[model samples]
Target chain A: MNIYNKVYFVLLFITLISYLGGFGKKPRYVRMVILLMILWFFTSAVAIYLVKYGGLTNNLFVFHISTPLEYVILSMLFRDVIVNKAIKRIILLSVPFFVALSVLFSVFIQPVDTNNSNIIIIESVILVFISLFFLREILLLQQVTVLHRFPMFWICVGILFYYTGNLVIEGMLNYMIRQSMELARRTYRFGYIFKYLLFILFIIGAFCSKSPRLLTKKEQ
Target chain B: MIISVTVVLLILLFFIVSFLFIYKNRQVRHRAEMESVKEKYNQEILKTQLEIREQTMKNISEEIHDNVGQVLSLVVLSLSAIELNDTTKAAAKIESTTKLVEKVVSDLRNLSKTLDADNVANVGLVAIIKFELELLEKTGVYRTLFRLSGTEKKLNGSKEIVLYRIIQESLNNIIKHAKATMIKISLDFSDTQLQVEITDDGKGFDAGDSGEKNMHRSGAGIKNMKKRANLIGGSLAVKSVPSMGTTVSMIIPFSPAG
Candidate 1:
């Protein structure tokens, strides 16, 4: 196993730790994000293993299934943070639209055997936009003092980091794969670093106190 | 080309993250500043409340001593001098003593009403101010007049209490320092505001000169009154000329209930 796989395994352990540590009890949104993350880790890990050893070469299938699910869950989580009823409704409405587009593109517009560049590009761009929007919304929320302590803030940061990195590398993914499989795999390893950064942020958010003034109270 | 693009995108992302971090820092700092201001405002309010309570206690102590104690002492003297066998003289002394006792009871009742903080709100500001003027008039120290104009309108409860205390502080000052022969308090209620003017024809000093030079002298009291006016969202303006008169005016805004 490479360093990327090692980090992935660590992430799995972290997820289990978060659950056992009861990070999922109080805040409904955090619990949903954690569960979605756990699901993504397991599903992706299984897909990678099958492609490598079990001779299942259709690696893009996993993404076709999981990427849209990730977007929907993250959007649902953001809905909890958003104060405006109208903006929240737009986010909710976008979920079904994105899910259908993902399905149709993976099935018809883009072939599943090759790198799903078109779907990946669309997902990366949409996720980046949503993440940035969330960050702006969090900024406008005056009640929040310490941004890092806020679970939604960390979640937005993680998404923004991951997708921003993913957008760059994945944009050239198909071309890179056609040139050299080894080069493409190496570039993906770099992307995995961003994935690691995202999970680390998730871990921090999970352990963060639920109360806004928890740190201030501790200081007092 | 792809590697170069990737590096550039990564750098752009880094910059975006940095910007967000900076924005978050600014927000946290702003929130901290707001919290501190709110805390200071709360502390001032608490201090004002404590001072009002202290002043009330002091007034109550003086009332019990100067008025009630003196009258009761006279009652004691009159009863002691009574000859038991002299029925006619004894009856006359007894009647005078009864009148003195009745005066003591009435004074005690008025003092009790002043002591009850709720009574200030319950009796209404107009009636309370009238009673205060009556007390001053009874003392025969100052010729006091209370005039009410326009329809009386009730205000926010706390605002009323604070306004009353401000008036009380002004009265205390007039008695102690102004050496006024005549005091007039006028309550004018308009559509949106209530104006209370407490004017005294006394040995008045320059209002501006005193506020600045004597902030340490009698300025603390003035500061206290101003702080209270700000607390109740009212404006307190003091105008005085040496030997002409002094007027302490408070304009309090009230929203009518539909």
Candidate 2:
């Protein structure tokens, strides 16, 4: 396998480990999100492999099928962390709006057969804001003695890095594709590798204790 | 240009993440330190309370053995000496025995009241101190004087308990160690503070003699008294000179916490 394929497969392995490790321990929403990520990774890996070897153009449709689900799961994961009632309501309302917008934009504006830069950028922005807000609330409200060991802290860090880096690359993807396909492919693969490397953080988060209180183990 | 911008953005992201990590680390450490201090203070308060309870129990045992036991032994002696045939003398003996039994009952009632820890808490500080002085004076060894001035305002229950213990400890020390003839206690209430002074005409230890060697031996009692005072946001001063009296003065600010 190429380095890109190796990286992608490593991420898949890690996500599977994280999903299984989170069983009974992590919050229900976290487990659900990890399960969805595992499915997305497995399907995307298979689709990419098939497209490269069998010369099938229809494999890209798997991404189209998974993208909306990913957005909804990401929003679900964040709803537990956000404290403000109004902000939480907005996030809860945005999931349906995001799904509807993605459908309309893919059908009429960007087409289902190609990469949807508009939806990708919107998703990145929303996910990034959620991550940032989670970090802000953690510092403001939590009496965290050890920051890195906290499960939510690791999750926020992972989301922030992945979405912020993805925002820059994904926003310019269409233009890069038109100008130079090789350069565009290289940039996309670089982003993909970076994104998977950061999933190590999610695995770390899954292994880490998710208690927000300092006296959790002490109380027990 | 795109490469440069990505590099700059990535650097900015790294900085932001690093700064947050450092900030969180500092905050958590500070909170942990504060929690440790709080835990230590609570432990001290608990220890002092337990010690006071143990001391009170010891005093109660002594009181019962010395005072109540002697009175009851007298009643037994009076009952054993009854002459049934001499009716006039028997009636007078019976009347005297009844009076002695009633006095014993009153003493037992007073002792039981002192045993109640809740009573000590709810009782005003001045009343508690005055009761202690009365008990001391009843012993007939030390001449006790209590002086109270200014309109007294009540402190919180726990603070009163602590302050009362501090004074009680000093009196016990005087009774045990000082061969003093007179013990005087004064409580003065100002607009913003309450001051207490207890002085004894006992053979006093030298104040300058509390060197490092004597700290654990001679100064532990004073340290304990000061600690209890500090727990109630009060200050304690001990002054003593050889052949002169020892005096303990505590100044507590009037606050809702007390």
Candidate 3:
């Protein structure tokens, strides 16, 4: 790590200490902090792995599978207390979300020929699901206070972009019906870039959580 | 271009992650400070109230010790001469002294009861207000009527204490200055708001025209009532109509307030 990267770790180390402190004392609240600390650990681990191992190609396995698995775990964590029922419904809809994610990895199975019709269908279905989820979250729970809404919003956008980009990747690499690298793939690269932005937003927004008291207490 | 885009993306990601870490820590610090402030505020209010109650009780205690105790002692000393040879006059004097002592004892008991509250369980807002009504009735100065409408649930200790103090202070103001006939106290609670209205058929004052120096001479008991209301995220308003009496209204609204 460089100087700035080293500085980030120092902040990470302090967060780790706070997280450790959380186990012992019960303030009015500390769950949000503990959740952030876990995210930091994973994030720092990713940075370290990138520095140590080199290339997305070398570790495509974890790079692909882990994110969808993380979302599934999150869906469970925010299970019932999520006031926004649509978020839960979207999480269920993401059954296809992870399946489409797995399809992207399966496409790598035929790495020599990336143009496959099944990959296009899977990616398209995911994009549709993501757009629907985003619209529902925005419309239904825009004002509802909850623990998961912020992170869920960004996750919706990220999935949308990830699916859209991967769809284009499948079309270009697998389909040779027409091939012009610069002209055909502009939107695809843009989508991939946008997905990264959404991922960063998701991680940061998770820090804005409050405790879940949705069904247990009547909100006035 | 890819290298530049990649570099920028990595930099942005780093900053967002860094900000998230700092923000989380900042929240912890802010929450800790808020709790201490709340606790400290609770302590300060408790201390002030203790001082005031202690001062009032001490004054009453001293009055009883000096005046009532001395009278009773004199009666006891006079009655000790039971063997006074002049049977008729001596017996009569003894009987008078005994009655004097009994009167003093009753007055002493009233002094203790007059200060308020038998115990912690009895001093809540509802209980204290009911006591004020009974005391007003005994005075025959003005009949005090009380109407309470609420479950009295979710009234935490801090809220209860502050409210009880406010009502006590306001009623004290009415009895002392507002030469009124009847005082009506109503404490109404709803989901969104809690309201207390104390109205009297006494000589009222102009709400706007504050005779501050005069009020200072008499002690700003009304100002203290207002301060108590303000402390609990509420307001106190006193309205008067010359010979028509005065009404003091206190309103406290719970959060997500409208």
Index of the highest-DockQ prediction: 1
lDDT by residue (tens digit), candidate 3, B155-235: 555656676667767776776788778889998889877888999888876544564543444446767777677777788
Two-way lDDT contest, 1 vs 3, winner: 1
- Model 2 spans > 4 angstroms off: A1-3, A18-30, A49-61, A80-94, A107-109, A141-144, A178-183, A203-220, B1-25, B36-114, B118-258
After TM-score superposition, the amount by which residue B204's alpha carbon in candidate 2 deviates from its true location, in angstroms, is: 50
Chain B TM-score, model 3, reads 0.69
Ranking by lDDT: 2, 1, 3
Per-candidate TM vs. native? Answer: 0.54, 0.52, 0.52
Q: lDDT of model 1 at residue A188?
A: 83
Across B1-258, the per-residue lDDT of candidate 2 in tens digits comes to 357447745765685579566767768675687688778867876776776678768867888899888888999999889899999989988899998899899888878756664356666778778888988898999999999999888887767777888898899999988889999999999988999999999998777755433334456888888878987889988877778988989999988555
Pairs that collide in candidate 2 are B156-B258
Best by lDDT: 2
DockQ of each: 0.10, 0.04, 0.05
Q: What range of 10 consecutive residues in model 1 chain B has the weakest lDDT sum?
A: B209-218
Q: Model-by-model lDDT, in order?
A: 0.77, 0.78, 0.58
Each candidate's number of clashing pairs is 0, 1, 6
Q: What is the lDDT of residue B251 in candidate 2?
A: 97
